[model samples]
Target: MAQVKLSAAGERFFGTNVTPRSFEQWIAFLRLELKKTQRKRITASHNLHSIYLRHNNPDMAEFYARADDCFIDGMPVRRLFELFSSNAGFNHRFTLMDNLPQFLMAAQREKWRIYYLGSTEHVAQKSLERIRREYPNLDMHLHHGYIKDNAAVVDNINKHSPDILLLGMGMPLQERWLLENFEQLEFGWVVQAGATLDYFTGEQAKPPRWLSAAGLGWLYRLAHDPRRLARRYLFEPWWLIAPIYRHWRLQRQENGTPRT
Candidate 1:
């Protein structure tokens, strides 16, 4: 199925399409589409500011562009849609944490075998325990993000052959890894879930809904892990302005308006 293109919003965010689908819509799409097409390869990449870094890295950016399904997982990117799209009413942000319960329920109902990759061994174990507590019948496997041997990792995934693969090893790396191994992965959906595993294990907590709604979730993350996220949360968002402006310029040019 073709991704419903988001209009008024630019066709591309940097180099990737700003394909905005709500949380409910995303679940529905997954259920319907995956049921219909078994060979369909779908990648769900979220947390928008990472796109700036992806933009700088051509390979990663191309993977984001090629994803069969893309959802806006960060607020700043939602705000950008509001700023740039005439039909912005449909855009909404849902983090990985916000999405997990419904997603797991659906996966359980659909009988999808899942593989969880990324995060430390402790976090991965704790996350699986929590998941099993909540979803007793969730057919899933876990592997810590520390594994460096790409071939071995691919071998393990192929051995199990999960219907869905959740890669939560954080941005660029997770996306890059997914793309690099895309050919070898015979799975339903490969999701790039940054810190979802940590959230599951209570190793990290998301900012309050208010902060996320106010587009300050990045700030909360920065406060919690300053040493790691400070540069990403502080500097990466600023990079979006250039692409947004470029989109605006293209829109104006298309409408027969003179450049300022």
Candidate 2:
């Protein structure tokens, strides 16, 4: 419920505000925010797929624009920031699966309440069991993403009154849910987490850290689940070409530099 002041130092890339914050810094900021009672804070992260969605979908665009803070969620987006922006500090990319353990540790230490809404019932239960084995003291809740009634789910979330809400219902659906029910939700921090719980449940293979760091995570994922990810990893990036070029041109104009 507290208003945590995240660093406003960031650049706008392809209509998304990219705030680059390290994992440790984010944990610290979450801890600091969890200590107070203020207003609900919505946080989002962007990859190529999300960026493409934001560009093509009005609802997705509204979600990103309304986010209190947005950060780079993929290496490709980070690389684009490095290439297009004047700032050299856009090196941080935070993925939920990569940082969830550390965040859960912080939650346990701080006694912060967490509610995760996504994944199937089986996967959610499996993930809960696994997390309990690792951090038994952590107070966490889970709900399946298949909703029969939106009002009921929102009511359940409000009753829990968790400090952090991890929504992993996938892209536009998750974003749309938040946009529609944001006012009714009472959580302190709402994070747009996608398929992160599935990784924990072994429903999806998480790429190695090295591969992700090297900007080949998408390839690994595509190889693993080509049916689900082929368009996103292989073809969707092509959709960004014109937008990236336009952004580059605008940046050059702003700097009073000659057009390429």
Candidate 3:
């Protein structure tokens, strides 16, 4: 388990060590994993700033910390790391949109099959159409996110044995599902992609580059889905204050300086 040991700043911002890899590097790693001869699994996940800010939920924090590979999915988290973690080389934040095309291209070139699992049945179908329209050469499969039988899902996945599984079933749910079924699943790469399917299906519109760069994408999302995201953006993020201070104290101690 490679832990990102940049410093307490990295930990405080992410609740764990986030692998500070750029989009190209991340795709390269996935390509290498696809080429590997082993039948083992390769897991990758992304965490939003809300994950680190969720101080009240120890389980969530621990899950993020223990993910085999974690990337920054929220621009705010990346911006915060850039501001506070001077030693961290995390200048760019790569969302599902940034990585999906590259991944699909790699999968196409290598003739790797893909299984997309997420979104409603309708949205999943729409996404399938979109993928076919855009990436006509890409071989892919699909499963809706409204899963009722966990064992059945596992069995189905094992039966198909796709090279990569891109799961868009939100955060903690996807993480927990992978934790329970990963050992039995037969995918080379399992990527937790949150609402990527929604974006693909045009159910959720992509935020403008300016808004995303300014770290206001959450606010834009909140403006759209207030009922669902108000608490996450407005209240949950307040929990980050405690960890930010704690990180500062640790830095002071490491520098052998007295706290003023």
Q: List the residue pairs that clash in candidate 3.
A: none
- Give one digit per residue, the lDDT tens place, for model 3 in 145-245: 89998788788877878888888787667766776676788887777777887765668866776887677777778888889888778776677666666
TM-scores of all candidate predictions against the true structure: 0.87, 0.92, 0.82
Over 1-260, each residue of candidate 2 has an lDDT whose tens digit, in order, gives: 44434554666767666677777667767777677787598778888999899989999999888877777888888887778766565467778888788888889988989999998988999989999999999999899999888898899899999999999999899989898898889999999888999987779989988988888888888899999998898888998999888878887878832122
What Cα-based lDDT does every candidate model obtain? 0.73, 0.83, 0.67
Which lDDT tens digits does candidate 1 get at residues 1-260?
44443323324444555567766666666666677656537566456556676768876767766776666787777776666655547676677776677788878977888888999999988878888899998888889999879789889988878878888888678877887788887777777777787876678867877887787877887898899887787777677677667877876776732121
What does candidate 2 score in Cα RMSD to the true structure?
A: 3.6
The residue pairs that clash in candidate 1, if any, are none
Q: lDDT order of candidates, best first?
A: 2, 1, 3
lDDT score for residue 20 of model 3 = 57
Per-prediction count of colliding residue pairs? 0, 1, 0
Residue 172, candidate 3: Cα error in Å is: 1.5
Q: Model 3: residues >4 Å from true position, as ranges?
A: 1-15, 38-50, 84-88, 256-260
lDDT winner? 2
